[model samples]
Target: MLPNNKIPEHLRSWSVPWPLYMPTFATPPELQPGPGLDASVAAGWAEPAFFPAVNDWPQRQAAALIPFQVVGGRPRNPSGRTGYTGRRLGRWGENQAADPIVTTGAGADRRVLLIRRDDCGQWAIPGGMVDPGETVPAALVRELREETGVDLAGYRAQILTTTYVDDPRNTDESWVVSTVAHYRLPETSPATAGSDALEARWWPFADLDTLLVAVADGGGRLYAAHRRLLGLCGGGR
Candidate 1:
């Protein structure tokens, strides 16, 4: 069972603005931190060492220094209030992720590879969390292979952008930041869905504007975060 972070009774009314409305929630059991807590710390909580304020971590590609203020021993989400405290995310601070944008053809004829995510059932670029000890470039390649069955390790990839994502899973204590890379292929490549992806397929680059408009209007099949990530890839204007 997961530990619950319950909101106070006084704060439970629907009249409360969403920013002020704290919801009772528990991090999913599967995403719970491992049993690595210090002897002095409580069980089911992340170790203090993982926190930026607790440790002097040198900035690296996999873990960039996205600033966050620590309050009551927890990192505060830099983007502002996210209702509840504690984290629905696995990490206590910045969760690093990598996105790979693979494309073929050029200009009007270009097509990009995308995957249908099992979690949200939205079509998104093939990507995943950057694992411990993995470089952002390596994570990009690995995630591409795992989600789309594309092997682009031999091809040159260009780093497009690295920025904090406005993911729904973000909380007051944890949030996601990602590095996006672009891989250009001379021709179409074979792609098969695997890992957390339900399906993988190619999409016309020109259609991204339409997709982005639909997503912005709140009725699209594209993942929310990917809308921003894809824009960094020169898509959707």
Candidate 2:
């Protein structure tokens, strides 16, 4: 557990973000310790067979190398202070996801596929969480098909990067990490929004920098972490 004096003053009094989906058993008062091991053990979400034990620092590091510390038997955020204690995310520790960067055309004509997220109503990469027991590649293909109705089976696919995502939904105990895969198609393919996407379409690669700048300036419609992910693809230069 982190020493009381070591916790930032502001965070020491921070309230947990109460999402409706969180179980009542897991809820706790502001600044109090998170759910206990008995609760997690009963919920079956913290089984060491599937997830790293709360105190298994070495195993957790080996899994994602995120450097999260154990605090009160829960994983503490390594990045810094957050507004919450217990997680709004479904699981404890690293919650893995996959981002599929589907693109068509070349040079100045390049275009990349994007989906309007239903939750935030912002344009983002067509991606979603990797289900338990699923491979990152499989999750990438599945998320692409589910969100944009695009099949990447025959496309030339390459893994671009795997890193921690600074998602807003992150809490002190849980955060997101993702694997980005780039898929290049021969030509523009038919796409329709499905699943959690409100709309899906291709956007000019040349406009990415502008859109990203708009986001930085607080006037853009792109998802924040996605902008960083897109920039890492080595496209739209």
Candidate 3:
């Protein structure tokens, strides 16, 4: 992907294959991170309510690091544009999210953890943004706890995959990279709905495909990228 492609005017909003663009527009003032915009500040509009105070994160670990160019003092999506420019999203450049694929039960009774997101009301893997100065694994653990109240205290996580997510919420300036990790749960581990989740539960691995295909048909919407990640899990495909 070219670094400075201009974002097309019409090919935005969940384009099947996102359009290529060299960003030529200036970033709006509200999206720009200023002095007080650190880890706790909201950026631009309010739908995405939890933008970090600071967004000047240096290169760190992520599933994929998309090459970007500065367009009007902001990192522009290099692969292409998603049309909407930071409409409801928090960060301007890369928003790193980590998902923990926690599982329990054995064989036929096996199930994987899932959380219903408060924003989109879709069943999704418990995850959240990577805070600055935090390692990817630590961020994964913290986000998992904040969203689902599941603690993988002594569990060692194996990174399953790292890749750029085709998030529906992405815009020309905002994109996401997801790092998915596997964490097997002890038979006794407990999970409860917490933080930004509306509900938390384990789903039988056998039912994963049905759920993914039915996401838009009322079964439940799974976050775009998450659906793909779940396919990598055993039987979920």
Candidate 4:
């Protein structure tokens, strides 16, 4: 579901300006298109996948609309091209991402693991795109390990929520949907920054408000979607 208030800064449209209105441009050479298996052959949990120009979004109560028409046979970003077009996110239209909130300790000592994204330099719960054939839970575990070196394979996670990601890269054609899950880390879990992260660290739940962020001219920080997700998980500043 869309946020009831203003879109969060990180997910707000950052597409470059176009005359009259912004339009999403093609993916740059450096960025590969979003990853996925062919829709024609998708099996099991991947059966319902939406492929570019291959499958139309199903008519159902659960499906969300993109609010724009297709361009070049691809979904068009309703808002326009984000500054980095396909640089970070590969696909347009319903990009699937997941976040795993790994917490450790308890009471006043409770802390959550966060990673500084290499591209944006902002602290956020570790997350990434879901490859075709992967379930949301599976993707969450894989992404958490890839970014923060935390193993959640044996941990029990609760599905906190699934909602549209207010990612700055969203366009009329491309937007993100994310599934957020939570896991209380074991006492022995050792987290190290890896993969797409610049650093990994644990922040006390009580001190979330004090952490400095790189977004909004440094006056505001924390990935916007994550801030909201954390709220739903009962973590508040």
Per TM-score, the best of the predicted structures is 1
- Summarize candidate 2's per-residue lDDT along 99-183 as a digit string, tens digits: 9999889988889999888877778899998877888888899999999999988666788888888776676667788888898
**If both were scored by lDDT, which would come out higher, candidate 1 or candidate 3?**
1
Task: Give the Cα error of residue 95 in candidate 4, in Å.
Answer: 0.4
Compared with the true structure, what per-residue lDDT tens digits does model 4 show for residues 1-237?
A: 122233345454535334444333444333332343333224222222234434553421124333445555555545544433332345546677888888888888888888888776778889998886678889999998899888888889998877777776564556777888989866736779898888787877776665543344332357665777777765643
Better of 2 and 4 by TM-score: 2
Off by over 4 Å in 3: 1-64, 213-219, 235-237
Model 1 per-residue lDDT tens digits across residues 60-160: 32245476665556566665655555565556678888989999998899899988888776788898888777898899999999999989968998988
lDDT of 2 at 24: 22
**For every model shown, what is its TM-score relative to the native structure?**
0.74, 0.71, 0.71, 0.68
Model 2's alpha-carbon lDDT is 0.71
Candidate 1 versus the native: TM-score?
0.74
Report, for all candidates in order, the number of backbone clashes: 0, 0, 11, 16
Alpha-carbon lDDT of model 4: 0.64
State the C-alpha lDDT per candidate.
0.71, 0.71, 0.67, 0.64
